[model samples]
Target: MIRFDRVSKRYPPGLDALSDLSFEVAEREMAIVSGHSGAGKSTLLKLIAAVEKPTGGAVLVGGQNVGGLARSALPYLRRRIGMVFQDQKLLFDRSVFENVLLPLSIAGFPPRDAAQRVRAALDKVGLATREKALPIMLSGGEQQRLAIARAVVGRPNLLLADEPTAHLDRDTAADVARIFHQFHDVGVTILIATYAGELFPGARRLRLDHGKLMA
Candidate 1:
């Protein structure tokens, strides 16, 4: 559901984050973008999310060109895609339930339906009981799970994760990996950007070096 056609992102002063990067991620397929630090993996994710636009060529999602999407339409585009980052980025003052409900709330979902979906998302992430607790009270692993819950609470069509398991012990890292697989199993198209072989042990690998995608 994602297509990058000769996409390149350039910053000021002779720096290119990605150059001529091209790939297609079919609907419902889970793929990992593996690379070392400063290798453009995060840039790719940002391009797909429309947080940043390609300086050349196009970024297409579900057949719509996102490279030049108007600022007014960004929220609409974001609603269809969920993103999880290394840091949970949770609001410490809000209850976990409220944080998960934020997306639905922004979309104008009714309170009753929003609560139901929030609970379901928390359950999916194995954080049902912690819904009433603040983020600071949770462990790093639990905080990450809470982030996952927030990302998927809207049943988004695409999920983009960046270094989701960067923190935590091996077991908790495995738990995060399992959660990604579960989302994939349920037909959510997921693109995860992480270090080589970090979370996706058996999945197909796409290596990014410097700024170019290589086989």
Candidate 2:
């Protein structure tokens, strides 16, 4: 679960990314954040993930104050959350399986268990047959699926995606949205920041405008 109380984020000398935003996302809930470019959607996601601290107010994830968390506790916090970016950030030199395996390896999971989880994650994203292939060899949609597999391999409790379908065609975007729906069905808290709301139906909508939440 996530809770933000009167949160604000100001960067550099005077740029206000978010101002007095407040919201709560319950466990096992799915929500879609929609806004124009530079509306602070990305910044809001970063606050939840602890990638950026709020300049004022408080951010709580699973009951811990993200802004007050010690540096040493960051890894533990991040382990409970999975994130996907618009760019897909896949390593061109690594095989699909390796990319998916990286998170497990970092968490020190046993090799056999990690292998099983990796394959399962790949299958979840419809990439089981392409595990041995490099990222550069896949189509845009396939690459994005691979990224999703990598993010979910650790079985994170919270899933956050920023502009997940920004580059895909309508059909492919639907495919990606279905993948997210699958995860949500199994009880993962899902929050996606997207410019296209039609891609996600039945999700609670949160809109922002010029750094302010639009009620």
Candidate 3:
């Protein structure tokens, strides 16, 4: 569950990334945010994740005000949310299994349980057989699946994906979309910011223009 109330984000030199934005995403729902470049899609996700704070109004996640969250509390907040960033941000030098395992290790999950969860995540993304391979060894779509596996290994409640299918061919993108649909079917709230929104025809649509919500 995420709610934004009159939120505005002003960067250095007073550039407004989002202006007077207000929206709500209910639990267990999937939504697609569509806009051209510079429409604040990424910034909106950053606000929910507490990587950036709004200059005005508030961003609330699961009823906790993210804008006012203490730095000490950020890790706790993030544990319940999974993010697939635009760049994929993989640990290229690490094995695929290690990349998926890193978050559990950091969160202090027990070794045995973490290992099981890592394997399950890979299976969900259809990457079970490639766990020992380095990221560089995978194809583009497989790498994207690897990123999704890493994001969900912790069983997060909310999944935020920024441009997940941007690089893939249509069929591969559709395959990736099916993976996300599987997670959503199991009750993970999904929010995707994408240029290829036709992949998610049934998701609630939120369009933006020039940093503001559009009708």
Q: lDDT of each model, Cα atoms only? A: 0.91, 0.93, 0.95
Q: Which regions of candidate 2 fall more than 4 Å away from where they truly are?
A: none
- Per-residue lDDT of candidate 3, residues 176-209 (tens digit): 9999999999999999999998999789999988
Q: Cα RMSD (Å) per model?
A: 1.0, 0.7, 0.6
Residues 46-81 of candidate 2: C-alpha lDDT, one tens digit per residue: 998788999999999998999999888888898889
When 2 and 3 are scored with lDDT, the better candidate is: 3
Please write out the lDDT profile of model 1 over residues 41-105, one tens digit for every residue. Answer: 98999999899989998999999999789999989999999989767678889999999999999
The total of clashing pairs for model 1 equals: 0
- Pitting candidate 1 against candidate 3, the one with the higher lDDT is 3
Cα lDDT for residue 16, model 1?
95
In model 2, which range of ten residues has the least summed lDDT? 79-88
Better of 1 and 3 by TM-score: 3
